[model samples]
Target: MAKRDYYEVLGLGKDASADDIKKSYRKLARQYHPDVNKEADAESKFKEVKEAYDVLSDDGKRSTYDRFGHVDPNQGMGGGGGAQDFGGFGDIFDMFFGGGGGRRDPNAPQRGNDLQYTMTVEFKEAVFGKETEITIPRTETCDTCHGNGAKPGTKPESCSVCKGSGQQEVVQNTPFGRMVNRRACTNCSGTGRVIKEKCGTCHGAGKVKRQRKINIRIPAGVDDGAQIRMSGEGEGGLRGGPAGDLYIVIRVKSHEFFEREGDDIYCEVPLTFVQATLGDEIEIPTLTEKVKLKVPAGTQTGTYFRLKGKGVPKLRGYGQGDQHVKVTIVTPTNLTDEQKELLRQFGGLSSDTSNEQEHHESIFERMKKAFRGE
Candidate 1:
């Protein structure tokens, strides 16, 4: 009989990946399997599915089929047949029967988890490196069972259902041929063993939770959202696997007087109208300390002065940034009688006129004048 295309039999496209092919085949196998289904022609559909999976699952067979659509019986394994020439489709069989199907072992040891710690630092501390300690809840392997998940006195036993094979097999008859399918043992959960008695401490988890102390050293010039990684400092790994990593995220506190942008510092210094009109040498606050700043003559409001090497330190390279000082002129108010007279005399000397206050006399003022007959 003419054979159908493997991808068509599995209800898959030619672009299907290995995983996609296996998933479709498993679902169809369970549905049409003669052992599982009692419908008529169930055996034939099951056989066809197995045969298609056999060709598509095996790498060499799939390659031959892709090029020639079929493997020649004469050129097959031992020059006899294709099935004999190639190995069993362990991928699906192991998945169904709970055996070694691929390159990875699900129960094998894996690297520990990676943890993140957000560490807040002062503005100065971020500019200059600091060392500090922190306490966190972490997971560690249990000392009682040594990560075996078994009690100290008793131990785990081989699964009786699978007889230490970790899988179960079923023989089914199909139109294409007779085949065998394997699946994981339901009793042992595919581990080939059962924990008759679990550890009292971890309760079969093989791990413990405890508070841990970690000391971290922050580098200089770290900006907000900067990240630092410490190796082998994460959660405990299973089966003695390597530890994971710990990441420290730096959060910098904002300064009251100074505002930072990249490596530069910004500040606004208030100056009186007299100081702005007549320039003088004044002291201004910087990131480090107060420094003498010369106010140029005729300095206007919103004028900016740059102080070199007075800002923040560079994160990676050498040298510092400049500090920008913005000057704002403050106008005087509440003039006394003597001050007002002097100001009026000064205004007369100048050509500019003083602002006149608007008079919005109400009806009551007119009534008072009329009652006095004025």
Candidate 2:
């Protein structure tokens, strides 16, 4: 494929200044950097941006390119200034910020990877809290080698290729000029150490996979999707680094009778027609125990009543939330002939123009409008 014009790649005209080229390159590099952009083509676009910047950032290369226009690599264009090839994203950052982009020491402490465990809790257990134990598989530093990845009484040797720096430098004479690049050493795989004798237990990996039993406490009133973090309880760190955290993600099992919304508990209580019309004291089940709830006379269906301090405990505060009970009047079924006749007689006692009938009709109309969001 033909190479794109350097000015076009940087989204600039031929008359663009050096400062404009640098600003456009920085913006494009940051936009297409693989670390920041996860698009599949971002890496290739980043390389294109870097290549464009490499030619335009220097005056000699820009002048040569302007004269030759994508000079063939086989017949190099003469240049007075050189450009350094960046190794990775770190190099770009080091160029923007003042740093040398030196190689890191592989023996330095690196924090362990964090682990997550999803736990399903019963509705009551989540509302009232409970302590439980779970077994999870994770990586732990080797006991025999003490996280060094070497056999007992033995040690790792410094990588001869990188001389313990974990990186190797390469110099190349490009069409532009001399270019230097730093890359991880292949001999030691960037670890800066070679293990002559591997540990038999962990197989020179410095860590072992094991099933560990962890005791966890689910706090009271923790709703579904709540997370409990346990510090230093994740996979063991490398080179004596501090362990990562263990996140316990709570998934609350649904209750058969109750539903929770934030700190409040909601439940639907069925009421017989007689009990709704003529008040009665009923036993209502709560998180702790059964409590007496009085149904007022002439209570309408879908009526909501609040039971103070009968809901789930507050996860962050002192008092508990109130439980909201919605009363639903259940029409009696399979009525005997005499019972049906009694209901008919009861209905006939209330005249069409009676004030009590009009009041009930008005209440039902208001409820209908409320349900319709009027």
lDDT tens digits by residue: candidate 1, 1-374: 88788899999988889999899999999999754575889989999999999878877557656866854443322332333321234433333345452433535776889888999999989987899999978888888997768999887777888876676666655443555556677888777768889999999777899899999998877789877888898988876777788888899999887888988989888877668767989999877688999998878666789999987788779988889998776656897999879866755654343433213333235335544556
The C-alpha stretches of model 1 lying farther than 4 A from their native spots are: 1-103, 152-186, 189-193, 340-374
Which candidate's lDDT is highest? 2
Model 2 agreement with the true structure over 1-374: per-residue lDDT tens digits: 99898899999999999999999999999999765675889989999999999878876567657866875533322343544445564443333344443435688997889899999989999999999999999999999998989999999999999898887777766665555556788999999999999999999999999999999988898889877888999999998988888988899999999989988889988888899889899988887888989999988778889989998899988889989998877778999999999987776664465577563654347456545656
* Best model per TM-score: 2
lDDT of each: 0.76, 0.82
